[model samples]
Target chain A: MLPELLQGVDTGGLLVIQDSASYSGRHLLQSFINAALNREEAVHVLGFEVSEEELKDGLRGSPVQRLHFHNAYTDPLGWTDHPAFTVHQFCLGELTRLVKQTSHSKPATLVIDSLSWILRHVSTPDVCRTLQQLRKGGAVRSIIGLLHADMHQRGTVGSVCHSATSVITVEPAMRGDEAVAKITKRSKSGKVIQDEEIFRIKDDLTVVVQSKSSKGAKKADSEEQETDPTANLTFNLRLSDTEREAKQKLALPFVFSKEKKTALLHSGPGSGRIHYEPDANDDYDQEDPDDDLDV
Target chain B: MYTELNSILNTTPDSFTQGEFVLLSDRQSDASFLIHHFLSLYLRARCKVCFVGLVQSFNHYSAISQRLGVSLTQAKEKGQLVFLEGQKESLSVLIPQENDTGSQAMDFLRDPSVGLKNLYEFVRSAVSSNGEEGGDGSEEWGPPVLLVDDLSVLLSLGVSAGAVLDFSHYCRAIVCSQLQGNVVMLVRCDGEGEEDEGDDEGSERLMKGLTHQCSLTLHVQGLPTGYCRDIHGQVEVCWRRRQGDGQYTQKKLFQYKVHDKGASFFAPGTSSAVL
Candidate 1:
């Protein structure tokens, strides 16, 4: 359910991943990219924050057939004329053409490694329009933009988030190794769905979702498995009521009763005697009274 | 290099690790002494250094380094240090030097939107190239270190925070990874009392981003107990080391006092002058 909600492929609307400086949303971004690739949808990543090599290294083992990484980081301003992708091409016209030429008119998932870059560079309204166009523009299936929430104004962050169909916010969890993702999605019928889950990114770039119920249930299951070694056996290991009573009544000979205590307490200092008690499991001979006769 | 700084960081004088990024940040106090320490440290270690001076001029830094025992003038004369004087460059060659074309290390000054790619390219070439012209051909020069002073000034100069971060990243990739060198960047941040100023997210994000990526973070801030004559400021150094499969950080706080010759670092509350 978490993956389905994160994939956001059923309704196909604009999806936004909001992250702060402390926690990164790149793992979620890669999850969406992985989902798109598994479903055979072409993925076009317009990376501006991290370099192309870094992004590629993160998505190293994933499918690269439909994965197209646009290089806005290298020569963003055409200063050196590197002939690569620049930051100025964040508009609708250029993206539509790239989609048309790459996936042969198939709708692709457009991922902005970060929308904060474009939002900071371009106008907020213009960026929103481009987002709406790319999502409803038919060539793109769903757009996932990573918004660094702390990097933009509250109004700009709000308007951009308001324009999206699904918003996933990634934050550091209580544990250092885990992150919490709060997902809010708007269905096609305008129904708002909200969810929260714990997740961790594996070394292989795969996201492992850890729901609360599943975590508790796993603890409970492991507890059940760890208990009662005598649970399954051919014979009954438990005792019935009569057997328990008999076992309790059949005591050994070392029992110290009230009379024995009183007798021992009232004894004088010179008193000396052999107090004998027979045990249930003790072996005794009837002719033990000087049968050897040596003494 | 000061032994106090090196010992606090738990680094030996001989062992060299490539691709190390050291981040210097200050909240309520000036942490430029750390930048000076790193400068003289690398210079004394025989590492080829590229100093990008945005806050102070070459003479200002040279004067201070002379006290610390390394001569920047002699280092530059030996082709060991490449200093990009940002203040002088911005004042002299903003528009009139289009035909000069000698070194456009400050090209971001001309075009803000173009970002700091040119600045990165300048640093890359300066450090990546061979130092045979400095003197010897067979001599092995140490790892190249790129030091940027006052990274916040770039944001004030019309360059965006994202671009400054990108310039740092590209420099790390090429200078650190490609050239097997290190990077030391100093950024100024707001104090704890300063918050919610509205629309200061650019610098705030830059500070947070730099803190997130750097291997070592040394945060210098003014003392919460107010001003003191014996102690200048307190520095919190966090050294992260990875062993086996997990990583843990060793965090320590030190009180320091600046002197005419060099700075003194000691454990907090152990200052003899304070007593």
Candidate 2:
């Protein structure tokens, strides 16, 4: 899906980017970052799963001035005296305080680099409570959290998904070497739109979404390339319209038709008889001739 | 030779991309041969290798690698290979010795909260690069390749399936994402869904979860007509190379016969009927 279908710049809600071990949602999250930056919404990243250097390296050529990255990766649990935000401080108040102190009244985007890490340490109800509070009332425009589906219990992942306004699941596309974002967007009127689109993160960090129909057309094009025997031949194997009509009209040597059958049954001159003239050299040998030779 | 498999997989040493995740699994027959094949492949590619051998000892792998014409000892001496014997480490972790503070490989045994963090960290630190850009250390090496013999042993050790999956996730972040290396995990799954074994649920969940995430999956299973003198089993290779113009998965099945030195792959029924 493109920007509008992705709920890029809409009213405040929780957008959960759920991923698995196979297809990563990092690039899609980057696309979301671009969307927020396009609107000039202040960006705050809570990166617990990755280092700041890696995050900076990912957005190398992009303008990162408005981007405020919180370093929870260096020491999420306070292993050393590193001056950074710990995973324990991943609460609604802390996030709101960070967003309010950094930007003006314009709603800012809050990204929890991943929700799986918090779900592991924090209780399911607690995380869901924070998600609800952040979405219902705050300066938060859209809260995006990356949740790894395989790392949590089914019931746990389900409960977290229940608290989300949009759940974009990253999965490998069925056709090609591309990844699909299965987005389940719940709009303000409580309408849910489920769509699967093949997406690529451009070098400039823009999401190039390939719709389902175009992907199917591309597949059909490839199959058309392989299966058509008439394609790229030395001789003209196809027939013209008139030639095909003439071929359809031409009858073979078999003289069996309804008129012929009726004429033979009724219009014969007399009784049908077989007349044979046997020559002197033409000797008709019966079964007895072969029987004598066998004995 | 791996020419047949290489052609089937469409992978060569030069084209083997960094940051790829490979999964090897078997339902009926053994798939350890594939792991051995990858070990030989990585060693020949001149990449720094870390092998977390949980199913067998180091000597067993050393012997297998020798048959494949690659010496693990020489690679180890050159600091190009790191081998962690899970059997030995599990033993050491199970039965503590007096003042044996050296081996922290199985520290997850005592600390379930950290899960396989210590083991994952060991893999991350052990295969530290030599002269190249260091990820977690500053030694000397080329691209890092982490190969786990199998992950089911961790499940059998009472570690939760989620924990085992988290271990792989962390490994992917460090080995594949940060370091731009490759991670290969082998898991054993018996049956799925309706025919699910009551106790093998963890391994099954782990395998199913992994299959969804793997860039390439080789599912090895025994022959349907039972064991034959000529054929051992079949391997179904599913290649999901996710970012090229040719993005679809190519799945093909081939039968294999395991000899002492190496194995041979052929189309189904051809190997037994012809050979």
Candidate 3:
């Protein structure tokens, strides 16, 4: 998605990515940085939300030694002993001065991790003015400003969109797991062109631009159905009077029937006593005399 | 001074900690009292304080402190308080041109360009007590608590939203990472009265962005039900806790009330008065 968007980016061109919660701006930024580094173009990242170490960790193992960072998240005094990175005060003036100083070396591609942080401290106009300065500054051929659109006001977003030569909005697809990137506005050499594209992020953190396909949609639908077997099943809630009556008739009783009790024994001939036999047994027991032997 | 408020905040599962940003958003324009209460807590705890006044002047703050039974003069004398008058600068820059006569304009002539950078510089100097003219040796005091009276002043002064955001992010970073102190910023929700949808959206966006950055967000507003007329206002506090790298636990909401002296929190269902 980023490469497709940056295909024709030239000197003095500004690209803005409007991101939402469903989309990660860091991924897009990483991709842009990687692409720039692959071409051996100098890349300077003005990081506000993340530190330099974190940025390096994000681009771990990439051959991006020409990359430099202006970290605003750590070290409030904006002082750093690191050879490749410079810590900057969170002030726009300081940032502008640093950009100018760097531009003196050569025209580089500048990528701001986020503009949302800058917006919180200053007004929209100040941000726009700074971007304008960066664009006109000879040090950078192109500038990419990443903004969390969901975190900013509509007016702020609108103003940023107006300031950029091209605006790319990334959002989550409505039905699929893929993210969708749309080119809402693009201006090339005094000509304004608008195009929309859908894309997704792969596991390797690369953006794959996808074409619109009915087969893809069908596949997604089938996957959805496969995940949920009840996807195609529907139930009716309303029932006719007769059907209701039948359902009521089919209902079981709530209470169970009680069981009858039975007598243990009935009077009969076997129940009669045998008194004479007990008397004879008792006389016999008296003479047994196992109890007589005290020894 | 903020015994009640502190107790209420303490009851939260994730209480406010040092090096955290707390945003106090005023929906009823009564955040000053809460700020005063919190500042009193800081002072009582013997914590050094740096007060950045954006909407109120030094005198106004001093007077409020007096009313709240806090001695601003004593605090300053003891080197416990540092006050930066941002309200003056903000007003000088924000006031309409028609109201700025020759003399008033002359008053601002000596000052450098009024913007977020200057405000940040002022705050930095005010917070750091190193190498200043004072030699009382109180500069070695513990980390100072930061209280920004009104952040909305910057927005009203026409500083860009981006600048304000960046300024806030830096301030938070400084207080949390370098100073290892706590910062409470007061912002007025001015979008309530905005008739333009665009302006409303802009203000909402700004508020949302600030809220997202802060560790705790307390929204103070007038109660919807007039039944409890004795209650001055109500506060809805939301605490955000990071669970892991990209995961965050659900924000916890706490409701409380502002009274004559301090705030009182009600158990979840104790108050039948819907707000």
lDDT of 3 by residue, B214-238 (tens): 7677777766664354455567766
Model 3's TM-score against the true structure? 0.54
Please give the distance, in angstroms, between residue A46's alpha carbon in candidate 1 and its true position after superposition.
Answer: 2.0
Ranking by lDDT: 1, 2, 3
Model 3, retained fraction of real contacts? 0.24
Best by DockQ: 2
Error of 2 at B208 (Å): 5.1
- Alpha carbon deviation, residue B102, candidate 3 (Å): 20
Docking class of 1: incorrect
* Model 1, span A1-295: residue lDDT tens: 4577555555358888898755667766877787677677788888766556556665667777888888776555565546466667878899988777774456788888778767756889999888887776787877888888877678999999999888888887766567888888888888998877787766555678876434555887999988987877899878999999999987567998887789878997787989998785455457695554587
Interface RMSD, every prediction, one decimal place? 4.3, 5.6, 5.9
Candidate with top TM-score is 1
Chain A TM-score for predicted structure 1: 0.69
Runs in model 1 deviating more than 4 A are A6-8, A34-42, A60-66, A100-107, A210-295, B2-21, B44-46, B63-69, B86-125, B131-143, B154-181, B190-194, B198-216, B227-275
**DockQ score for model 2:** 0.17
lDDT score of residue A141 within candidate 1: 77
What digit string (tens of lDDT, one per residue) describes model 1 on residues B67-91? Answer: 9999999988778898998888877
Between candidates 1 and 3, which one is better according to DockQ? Answer: 1
